[model samples]
Target chain A: MALNVLICDDSLLARNQLKKSLPADFDATIVTASNGLEALTVLQTQDIGLVFLDLTMPELDGVGVLEAIKAQALDCLVIVVSADIQPQMQQRVMELGALAFIQKPASADKLAAVLHKYGLI
Target chain B: MTALHFTEEQRDCLQELVNVAMGQASDKLARYLATMVHLQVPAIKLVDTQQLPQHFAQRYQQQSVSLISMGFFGDQGLRGEAIMLYQLANVDVLARLLEYSDDDSSEAEMLTDISSVLTTTFLNGLAEQLDNSFSYAAPRILSSRDQHFADKLAATAQQWQLALQVDIRYQLTDYSFHCDMILLIPGEAVLRLRQMLDQILASF
Candidate 1:
């Protein structure tokens, strides 16, 4: 079965970049959300297997989304992709059970490596 | 001058870090604009709140400016604000460089988008070098028109006793446009940052 992936970010440009970074032949049903609230709604409505999350956004943020997932014991994995390259932020997400963290302008190679490391490929 | 909030070594380290971050931000801008963006040697200073208004006025004069500002926080109560200021006269020029239609709405949207990317990219670059994680609020447009930019900055400076200011000049070589990016880090954050630097220096 193809994994269900969600890309959540406020910027159209950033969301597009994350989508493009996915492996060309990767098999997955991808969804997109522009903010944390919408991201949670999608998580609840869809059987999301993995998430590419951005940190800074209005309405809700990446940390809030992570907290919501943890609070509800959601099964989906999260990989943070953001321009907020603070080590503490990365540690916070990881401590909250994020599968991995990737910086902004996510490249195809980096995405592939993370996906492979998590055996999501 | 008043006693320096940061020791010379700490100041030097911070300047180097800011330079690296500015370089990364400029590279991203270069790719976005499809042109080379040059950054002047950044000037970092620690100044009192009373001096901020006068300092900004002296630097920017009477130019109407557009400002994008955001707040960021990290572990151990580290926090600061990053503000990007551009002369209002160049908005249309910037829109054209970005290949957007020369309309008021388009210029506004493009300016916000560009500021968002630049500010976050620069902050993230700095965070990575410091080996720390930070969370930032979404960027907001403080002003998008010609106005007393210095007065506005001064008013905001009232809440803080001291601030570390990093001033950078961003020049778009292919286009006749350049702007100043200023980072205002409050004294508390600077103290924490100094601790982090000391730790790093000791490690090395």
Candidate 2:
């Protein structure tokens, strides 16, 4: 099976951008969840390897979802995509076990570098 | 003098102050967006919470506008001393100007991603300035979206005693957008903001 990726965000726009930014040569199947709650549900059934999560959402924000993922002991890598790019928030997310943090509207090249650094690409 | 009012002279000074601050904000945003943006000061209104909606309606020509609101609390805590409001158009154009896009995605994500970037950039810049000058960390954007004008103003009314009102217009090419930033704070916080402003003025 190709690498399964889960994208969780409240904004439809963010999901689209991450999908578009994926490296074309990478063989990965992308799945999306509208919010952290939905992401938790989808994650329970899917063998997701990576997650591109957003911090702010209507229900069960990103930080909450990260906690849930941790509580469930799911072996998934998290990479946060947020508009709240405060250094403090970044540090907090990193401490929570996210492999990386990508500010919003990240370019494909920038993302590719992040993925490569994580050995995910 | 619980309810402070700006005299005509003070109003002009405040207007110029906001203009300079906004000019710097736009310049920072332009750098982030990689495009030029022009801002126009249509009018500045000093109103209480009750008069906010009517002012917003008249400004946007009775059209429901998409609004983004954020609050900043400095030194003394929850007495939010400053806040920001950006029209959706200003945000959208800024995103476009920044060339925000993904190679293969639906239009929706493109917009969301751009929205995220715009929020981050605008908040970060404003926060840095406030923090540097007033020891106020950049305000945290609690949330951002295409919200109705009435809903936005109503929600703001609950949180603050409206301190001041700034009406601004942003334009580029064929697109035009308007914004109303209503500064809100507790009585004490308002005093701090004024003091901060005085110090900033003195330094310059």
Candidate 3:
């Protein structure tokens, strides 16, 4: 069975950029959410195995989603793809259980490397 | 009052960092628009918040402009707002570049979207160079029509006496439209950023 993946971001452009960068060889059912609230709904209702999350969004931000995942013990891996590339911000997310953080304008090779590092690819 | 001061070396370092961040923003825009975007060497200034109105009035008087403002926070208590200013007359050109249908309402929406993307990209680029991460709030359209630029800033101008302002001009190579993006870091955040700069300089 193919893995389930979720891409959450408020920008349509950003979501499309990440979606376009996904490797063709990767087999997964990709889902999308524009905000933290929508992402949480998807998480609760779907068996999403991986998520590509953006840090800034309306309604709820990436950190809020991480907190929700931790609170509920959601079974999934999250990799943050954001433009807020502050080191302290990166450390905070890592501490919150994100598998990795990638900077935007996402690239295929970087995405593939992170996935491989976590044995997700 | 002791004027906020930055050593020549510190000023150079900060300017260089802003240059790199602006480069990243320009590249993203170039790719998105599939056109050449020219970025000017940013002019950096440290000024009192109260004096910003005079600054804006002198530089942008009588010109209609749009301002988009967003707040960002760092774990080390570094916080400030990023504001982008565009001439209202350039809205039509911008809409064309972004490939949006030309209309009044869509033009407003396009400005917000472009502002959000540009601010996030630029801030993230700067943070990446400093090896820091920031949490940003959703960008808000502070103003969208012809107005005194300084008046809009006055609404949320309190909280800090000193601020570091970086002014950058983005112009398309083949177009007459241009934008002036100003990044303002308040007194507290400026202090924290200087400390980080010191650490970075020490390592080099």
Of candidates 3 and 2, the better by lDDT? 3
Q: What's the C-alpha lDDT at position B137 in model 2? A: 43
In Å, what is the interface RMSD of model 1? 15.0
Quality class of the docking in candidate 1, CAPRI style: incorrect
Query: lDDT per prediction?
Result: 0.77, 0.60, 0.78
Better of 1 and 2 by lDDT: 1
Write down the worst ten-residue block by lDDT for model 3 chain B: B154-163
Where model 2 places Cα greater than 4 Å from the true spot, the runs are A1-121, B7-12, B41-45, B76-148, B173-175, B197-204
lDDT for each residue of candidate 2 in A3-113, tens digit (9 for 90 to 100):
899988665545665788788876899999988899998888889999998775657888888888888898899999765454555777888889899876545887898
User: TM-scores across all candidates?
Assistant: 0.60, 0.45, 0.61
> Cα deviation of B14 in candidate 3 (Å)?
0.3
* Residue pair clashes in candidate 3: A86-B132, A86-B133, A87-B131, A87-B132, A87-B133
Decide which is better by lDDT, 1 or 3.
3
Order by TM-score, highest first:
3, 1, 2
Off by over 4 Å in 3: A1-121
Tens digit of lDDT per residue, candidate 2, span B1-204? 246665454454445445435554554444554444544542565566667766666666644354434444444343443444455445555446546553323323444443344434433444444453223344344234444666556666656665566554434424554344555556555565556545534433
Ten-residue segment with the worst summed lDDT in candidate 1 chain B?
A: B1-10
Q: Give the per-residue lDDT of model 3 (tens digit) for B157-191.
A: 65556657788777877777777766667666778
Q: What are the clashing pairs of model 1?
A: A86-B132, A86-B133, A86-B134, A87-B132, A87-B133, A88-B132, A88-B133, A89-B133
